[model samples]
Target: MSMTLFCYLMMYCSGIVSLCLARKHIMLSLLSLEFIILSLFCIFSIIVTIMISESYMMLMFLTFSVCEGVVGLSILVMMIRSHGNDHLSSINLFLC
Candidate 1:
């Protein structure tokens, strides 16, 4: 694999590991999820470039990722407003 591809894969793996291990805070998990999304975007871009295909799909993918980020941030804001912090353990579905 190329160096760039290897770097992206490593980034993806690290994001997964961080997401799994850093469960104390919602913000950490969100950041890890974003990292994973970015790595996926990079990999997808590389594939599309290699194939010399149209870039409309990449634009769509970017749009979806941005939407996902907005939703996640909104949720985080709501959580902080309600609970006063971003701790995952502090979130109780029964209380909601």
Candidate 2:
């Protein structure tokens, strides 16, 4: 594999590890998730470039990733406003 591909794969793996290990802050988890998405986007773009294919799919993926980021930030903001903090453990989903 190319060095660039290896780097991206390493980034993706690191993001997964961080996401799994981060059990305290919701923000940390979100950041890890974003990192994973970014790595995937980079890999996808590289593949598209190598294949000389149309970049519309990459553009669409980017648009969806941006939307996902906005939604995640809004959720984080809402959680902070309602709970006074963004701690993952503080969120009690069982509470009705």
Candidate 3:
């Protein structure tokens, strides 16, 4: 159940992809963050569950994920409002 090296590589690759793709869409920016967070949480939980059965690190990860998701969504809203639009047709200098 533990995360292996392969899982780490996969998560890294996906995070990069998410970063690239999310640049083109506001909604996707939020979604991609969620994807990255989920992958991180999953990987940590897998490794913890296998190596330290009694550790509650996974629970902390889950809590952090929720908080992050909330904060990320709020940021998305702020970004859209500040930009005065939701479309990401132009490269956002602030986000960059």
Candidate 4:
């Protein structure tokens, strides 16, 4: 409805598209996922602020983002340490 909301929507879509297209690249894909998640968190915070005019929700979302970032980086580090190549296909066997 608002310009900010529309911008967030477009960014969210672009992040999804980038992630889907960057299959063999581990770093790019993981970062793209983070981008999507960050955008979603931003959108939710914005909506919450508009509804309640509160900023604590933004801090809560950011804390969750920090946790997700830590986990994603840890997984990537392990993937690199084991395979020496950070591609998704190389990590799938570990999952299965």
Candidate 5:
């Protein structure tokens, strides 16, 4: 279990790096964000289970994360429709 927690932590770190490096590609950045959120969910689940043994909060967090992902996807779709591309450079220029 400890090993699993360590792996999740590593994944979370890598996800952050990926998000930073893939800033130009909106889809890739969003995928990295998803990875980060999932790793966080795992870490929280393990900690909460060990400390409080209640999963209600975890479930609520999962629901919120799902809603967040949906909102992100919607925004991505709108960007694609308006810009016809998913690159940050294009978006920056469009916004300006």
Candidate 6:
């Protein structure tokens, strides 16, 4: 693998590990997830660039990541408003 690809792999792996370790902390988990997404985006962009001359794949991935981030933020806001906390355990999955 190239140096850039190796760097991306390391970043992606560390992000995944951080995400797993930060499961209990909502903010930390979200940041780690974003890190993972960014690394994946970079890797995909490079691959797409090499594979095709006309590629919208990177744009599509960027949009998807933005949407995902918005959704996650909305959920966090709702959870904080309703539960008065941002911890995963504080969220009640089923409430009637």
Best by TM-score: 2
Give me candidate 4's TM-score against the actual structure.
Answer: 0.84
Q: What digit string (tens of lDDT, one per residue) describes model 6 on residues 1-96?
A: 489998998999999999989998688888998999999998997788788876787888899999999988888888789889888887676974
User: For each predicted model, how many residue pairs clash, with residues at least 3 apart or on different chains?
Assistant: 0, 0, 0, 0, 0, 0
List clashing residue pairs in candidate 2. none
lDDT by residue for model 3 (3-93), tens: 4757765886788698886686777777877777777776776677767877577778788889988887787788777787667665457
lDDT of 6 at 82: 86
User: What is the Å distance of residue 17 in model 6 from its true position?
Assistant: 0.1
Q: Please provide, for model 4 over 49-93, each residue's C-alpha lDDT reduced to its tens digit, 9 standing for 90 to 100.
A: 778887887888788888988898898888889889887676666
**TM-score per model over all chains:** 0.93, 0.93, 0.68, 0.84, 0.92, 0.91
**Count of backbone collisions in candidate 3:** 0
Model 5 lDDT per residue over 1-96, tens place: 989999999999999999999988889999999999999999999999899977999999999999989999999999999999988788665555
Whole-model lDDT per candidate: 0.94, 0.94, 0.74, 0.86, 0.93, 0.88
Query: How far does residue 15 in candidate 2 sit from its true spot (Å)?
Result: 0.4
Could you list the CA RMSD of all candidates, in the order they appear? Answer: 1.2, 1.2, 3.8, 2.1, 1.4, 1.5
Flag clash pairs in model 1: none
Q: In candidate 1, what are the lDDT values of residues 1-96, reduced to their tens digit?
A: 499999999999999999999899888989999999999999999999999679999999999999999999999999899889998878778965
**lDDT, candidate 2, 1-88, per-residue tens:** 4999999999999999999999699899999999999999999999999996799999999999999999999999999999999997
What local lDDT score does residue 32 receive in model 4, on the 0 to 100 scale? 96
Angstrom error of the Cα, residue 82, model 3: value is 4.7
TM-score of 2: 0.93
- Best-to-worst ranking by TM-score: 2, 1, 5, 6, 4, 3
